[model samples]
Target: MCTWFYAEKATLSPIITKAQQLPLTDTIMNTMARSAAMSGNIRPTDMAAVFAPNKQGNIAVFPMIWGFTVDASPKPLINCRIETADRKPVWKDSWFRRRCVIPASWYYEWGIPPSEVGYHNA
Candidate 1:
């Protein structure tokens, strides 16, 4: 989603620490190091460049073009249902190979009443 997400500083500490340990080429290391210095938190938009994939199935030392979130007329897609992801054209490819985890302390869900039931009281 284009809407900025919240990530706890505590949760990001370990990930940034580990990224620093990665054996990136001098160029890549320099870029990330600079960005990290400027911004206390690493932005996900810059991750593809820092942790790109290589032809040999290894992490590339250089950054690459990362997918960007778009602000469409409709609300941005914040969540995708795992069950229908494969069938959806926009997400099919990324779902298969470019999957990434979103760490969150909490999530939101909506409740809908059963259509068949006229009314139910507890």
Candidate 2:
């Protein structure tokens, strides 16, 4: 499972602004800039800018915590596989009802490092 993600404000900002028909406020832009700079990787518990439907069903930017918590584990659940999401107890409700779009360029997998696994840019 991937617990880390990356979002580029430069790419996300325009889409959000256009959707809302307004420029992103300075505060929101500054916050995103700082957060992205503080850690290139956005991990569980980190605040992230995500897109979700509002009451009117219009997409909007919102600050969201990166994961879901469960009693069975000390760490939060960051990823839910589609194959098991509906069948799994922990993800059942959210899978059916709650949803949000995370605008991430890419994510890192757990365990073995990419370099050790011989991954390289083409």
Candidate 3:
């Protein structure tokens, strides 16, 4: 499962502003600063950049906490398998109706060997 994702302000700024035409106001800079404070390792409950549809149905950038809350879990849950997302009660609605994209330069998955991981400077 993907437990963490990376985002850099320098890389995302262009996409957020030039391509998406969104203004990089002070509020957005603050959000970017928070992401940087984590060294781009955005885990569950952290403020992460997400691209989701606004009320106008146009894609917009948002700083969102990166997980879902469920009574079944003691903490927020972050991973949902695509195959089971539509079938699972906790993820069904979000899978079908309220989908959003979490922007990342890359992701980190647990249990993988260092040699096989993306960070390995092979």
Candidate 4:
């Protein structure tokens, strides 16, 4: 499960600033630049940066709440197994209707144990 990830503020700002030059994307990109300077570890339910298109069709980069609620478990869904998404009613409609891109500079792997801490690798 991709429970934790990171975003690079250094490169992200400049990139967004440049991309904002395109028509219809200036406002959203500028907004993203103002608050996108987030670095270090991000956990489930935290506000993390994601890139997605709004109803207007302009690409928007903003911080959104991670994970979605599910009735099967008390914990929020932080990951999805793509292969079975079509058969799952909870994720089917969303998987088909919505599209999102999660930007992460790095991700952590916990091969040792669930409780033990793990380090982020490039």
Q: What is the model-wide C-alpha lDDT for candidate 4?
A: 0.59
State the C-alpha lDDT per candidate: 0.43, 0.63, 0.63, 0.59
Model 1 agreement with the true structure over 1-122: per-residue lDDT tens digits? 23233334354555445544555524554664444321122233434223445678776334332233545524335456789889887678777787444433222233322122232343
Deviation in angstroms for 94 in model 3? 0.9
lDDT of 2 by residue, 49-89 (tens): 67888889898776666789888998887658899999899
Pairwise lDDT winner, candidates 1 and 2 = 2
Model 1 CA deviation exceeding 4 Å by range: 23-34, 37-44, 48-83, 104-122
Q: For candidate 4, lDDT tens digit of each residue in 29-118?
A: 355333233344556655556678877988876556557777788877766788988778889988887767877666665542132244
Query: Worst ten-residue run, lDDT, model 4?
Result: 111-120
Model 1 residue 112 CA deviation in Å? 28
Q: What are the TM-scores, per candidate, against the unseen true structure?
A: 0.40, 0.63, 0.66, 0.63
* Candidate rank order under TM-score: 3, 2, 4, 1
Whole-model lDDT, candidate 1?
A: 0.43
RMSD of each: 11.3, 6.2, 5.3, 7.2
